[model samples]
Target: MSRKTVEFVFASAVTTNGTFTVSYPTGYTKGDFSRGVMHRLIALQSTFESPKGITCSFGASSVTVTYKGTTTIPAGSKGIFGFDIAGPDTFRETDWKKQNHIINRPAILRFVNFGSPSTVSTTALISAATGTEMPATAASITYTYATQGGSSPIDGANTDGKLYPARNIVTTVTHASSVPTMTVTHTFLDVNGNQAVETHTTSGGGTSNTITGSKAAAQLISTKIANASTTQTTTGATLNVGFGSKLGFDIPILDSTQIAMEIHDGAMQGVWRGNEILPFALGANEVGTGGVLRRIPAPINGRIVSAYAAVEVANNANNAGTIAISIEQTNSNGSGVTVAGCELAFAASATIGTVVSGSTAEGAATAEVSTGNQICVVATAGFSTNAQFSGSIVMRPTYTVRGTLAVADITTVPSGTSGDIYGTYTPAFTLDGSKQVGLLVWTPEPNSNGTPQYTV
Candidate 1:
């Protein structure tokens, strides 16, 4: 809403240290104003005028002026007095926030003479102010919502305040619309909050800088960078990579042996009681050997590197026989086939705590296992009832551990300077692929000489 005021200067000179009055022949009225003003006035006048330093006041029907200036009022001296169109005594505008006006046109104002030319008379005729139009008025009125795309225009079909003082800007605005904000679930923004990413640098500069994120003493969406931060030594240095690089697994192993041991329990699987042998669940003594000793699920895609089984207790000394156990796996065709070079053998005299490696004499097909495959620990033909033994298998990963990724999901909060500041998260799987592939890629920011060091 807007409030347009029309005012001008009083032509005739004003009196010094004297009084005059202005009257509204027609009765005046009052209403609410945008500035929170609710005065019982159809017209307003300045209590003090410049140059003449005159003072004025309003009565129920007239405005009285008292001049106290040391000099005579200039001939074309200007004075401002605002008067709104007459309206009902009580404000009728329901949206009380807007400035209201009765209508627009010229106002008739009669100024009483000022200062007495005759010193003895004490008061006499002086000048009067000019006239102007008080065209209809306005102050802005609407509700807006600043959303994802942009701030929608003033709601409702009313308008953008095009009254007497047409303008697009509003001093006070309140957003009360129930419109929800559109969501931008995923966006390609940079880690530094800049536009498209730049080229990568192979090294770091020599300055120290802290890249802070929305944090509470925890998390990795940020890191400390440097204009000249040392990366320590090449062979052994602590590296602060902002996010994961590419496809890889968080297997609890970091080496070939460790990975092999991860696929199966490294401990012996068998039952024993105080050095006494019992009937084996694996048919260790009953079947004599040459049958399935145990079966386990192949939980990962890897190559079996070693397989071993051992006797937990010696067979009865009365009967003599030989026993051997080897690792085997069910292929996609469901056929139980023996793995190459993976076996553990025992002689009739074999005692407690005897361990033997699987033969490992098979082709590559039997050595590799896919997820969902079943592992079978088969034994060579031999027999005994007290032959108790334990077994285990080990396999190494067939894929490289990327351990990193290229980009992370970024979220930003505006900061006045360089650009918007952002924090990020690395997704648990490949970015857009449905497959649960663990992969991430990372590169130094363009124009950034950031160096990533190894943490030893």
Candidate 2:
């Protein structure tokens, strides 16, 4: 389909810094233009000055412009912004047909600012002689972070080692057919090279399907961590989603504190998934009880890849003290292995209410600990007066995957003759015992008698 150009002209006066909304022409929806296309068109046709700190974003039927600076346009000033809309092509078509197939696309502009009152006028220019309408039929899937548990406070005095809470990832599927069954697959590795796979299916006579993380699955994950040997050392997992015989997409997962992934076909058809790292803390006062230690349990059977320590101290008047901090790990039998250490000193009469922080990397001779080993932070203080302090140690573990896990599947045909399948495979580990998780999503081609696979 050919691209259509639409222009919008607004004559408005702004007396204050705020946001303004300009609605698109009638018949055109937000998803009609992809983010990339909108950005390109805006960069080409936008007359709004960036020096004014003006930034704009496109929505279903309108554009919201925000002025970050204190600049104001004189009354009756004209602001022109325009963009070209061409619906997704054959391969890119998400929820709608080609751009040429859409008719009655309207350009409507409206002023939306609670700031000073302003008057504005708008006009739309469409380059099409006639518009065409096309039928829309597309299925979609979405994912969200459901809930997470198993978190411990980071206060400095907790000695009991606690396992990280089990996490849940949820997804929803919407289809046009009744009694649609969707299959989801999960593949993850423990600190050991052991890979586990879980699959679940749900179907009913409804338009929407929701799959929640099962308690059994959570238990399985926890069990894997507990069973990890001292030698196992892997981090993260590989994830993929499939739609029976239709298509599938691979989602990315990595060693980040928090990550979010979104899959979009056009605008309306897509999925979103994300994960977050829980935080830990501890606090204490007085030199005697002021020493604090924190431990991070191994998620899977994996060796420590790296370790670091951070400590903060607050001292009162007449307090002369020295604080020592170290990162240590234990063997399976609970023997201690010191990985790194640092020391902080406060002088008497140096200053009242002085705060100090010390951070250090692991010693050069630091060694990696095995799975089931406890990695900890230990602190000691010698003081003549009162002092308060707290600290935490973080250790990253690495592991390998023994085998592949098929996480998701969809069957377009009743006999399951035509469908999509998604799986994850672990590659070889690096010298540090770390491996990359692979996501695979593919569908069998019908003409090839289901022999040829098409990857997405």
Candidate 3:
């Protein structure tokens, strides 16, 4: 016979101790079914259960196995042939308590080839844990190849490999979609309760700095920056950063929607009288658009019965002078406060704000204040002389203001001038329902400077 004809004849024969052929049905899952077939046939072809009781049947187009019990071969299935026979079995633990323990009963299998079977232990192959036994159109199957001695033949070919045919398994579970939201704020002030200025190193030696006060403190809290003073820098002494002084304060953020702050008012009280007194012009340049000082809108409405303003004056023979500062506000035209449709006049002695009649070394001395009058800060001592004073005052109508400024959300508070100082969260999630609630909070950060650069 010809070699080709001999090869054909050899391939057509089914060996009881060596090989077998697999024939998938025409309507079987259209793609790969190797693993599916293998898993199904493994149990049917098992000899460990009954040894000789297990047997295999070969057909002209496909193969089947018969055992003590009945079995079925779907459109796509697998088969294995070997001289050694083994199958799944059950083991028990000596002690009842250890029966369910993994160490007590473990699955085991043993097989040996009697003859020089080239496909016994040598060509033995098994699929990995078949996650499930579904008739996937395109399933994957894995098998192993070994030498006649049952040892791996390829260098690393024996290593584990995975296969995912054109199919997948299905599973069901539950997941969640919820998150969180927060906000922050900060403030800066001078030892004298005035806005402090800081020099910047980036303004081409310019003396531009952030103004120190509740405004600066509010900025810090809102931005969630660790330290604002450290962020200030300078290059040359051509100019001092007098835009704002170096001042720091803490404003407590109570809740997502509210915050409270206890500000440090500079020195002596009642220095600033009612609108009756004209506030020192400082100069026409300081007056701004209106005759009003630039200020953050008050959070609520109240009166400044009195205040404390403090200052330190350096002795300078060439520039010896004194100046004082004070403030007063009112809802004179019913723009701020009105009770029971009755318009209250600021001219009324009852309409009181704040008065600072005290003085410090650098500036103003005794400045009397009254209702419907301007609060004044008069220099009682010399500016060039060593002078410093501290004082407090009485407030009327309970100083209460409303905060109307809109705040944004925040993620992380910036630190050490390196990380993000502030962030706003959106599409805020809630712990309660499918929808979410939006709000904000200020995260806390430690101080960088132990004390103020200039004391009040």
What would the per-residue lDDT of candidate 3 be over residues 1-456, giving only the tens digit for each residue? Answer: 000000111233232333334453433321222111111224333521112223334354443433333333332333333211111112444444543312222322211111111111111112111123111122221112222112221112112211111000011111122110111111223222332222112112222222111122211100111112333221111111111211112222212232222111221211222311122222222211222222222222233333343332222344333233343334232222111111111111211132224322321222222344333333322232233333333333222212122121111111211111111111211112222222222222211121122111
**Can you tell me which runs of candidate 3 are displaced by over 4 Å?**
1-201, 205-412, 415-456
- Tell me the TM-score of each prediction against the true structure: 0.28, 0.24, 0.15
Candidate 2 per-residue C-alpha lDDT over 374-394 given as tens digits, one digit per residue, 9 for 90 to 100: 555444444433444443333
Q: Write the per-residue lDDT of candidate 1 for residues 1-456, one digit (tens) a residue.
A: 122333455556766655554453343422222111111212123333211233334466655555664456565655554332222323444544535433332222221111111111100000110011100112111121222112222221222211111001111111122211111011112322222211111232322211222110111111111112232212111121111112112111112211111110122111121211112245344445446655666666666767666677676655444333223443433337666666455667777777776534334666777665766655555547656666666665455322212221111111111111111122232333222221121211212211111111
Query: Residue 129 in model 1: shift from native, Å?
Result: 58
Answer with 1 or 2, whichever has the higher TM-score.
Answer: 1
Rank by TM-score, highest first.
Answer: 1, 2, 3
lDDT measured at residue 376 in model 2 versus the true structure, 0 to 100? 51
Q: Native-vs-model 1 lDDT?
A: 0.32
Q: After superposition, how far is residue 368 of candidate 1 from its true place, in Å?
A: 3.8
State the local distance difference test value for candidate 3.
0.23
Worst 10 residues of 2 by lDDT: 121-130
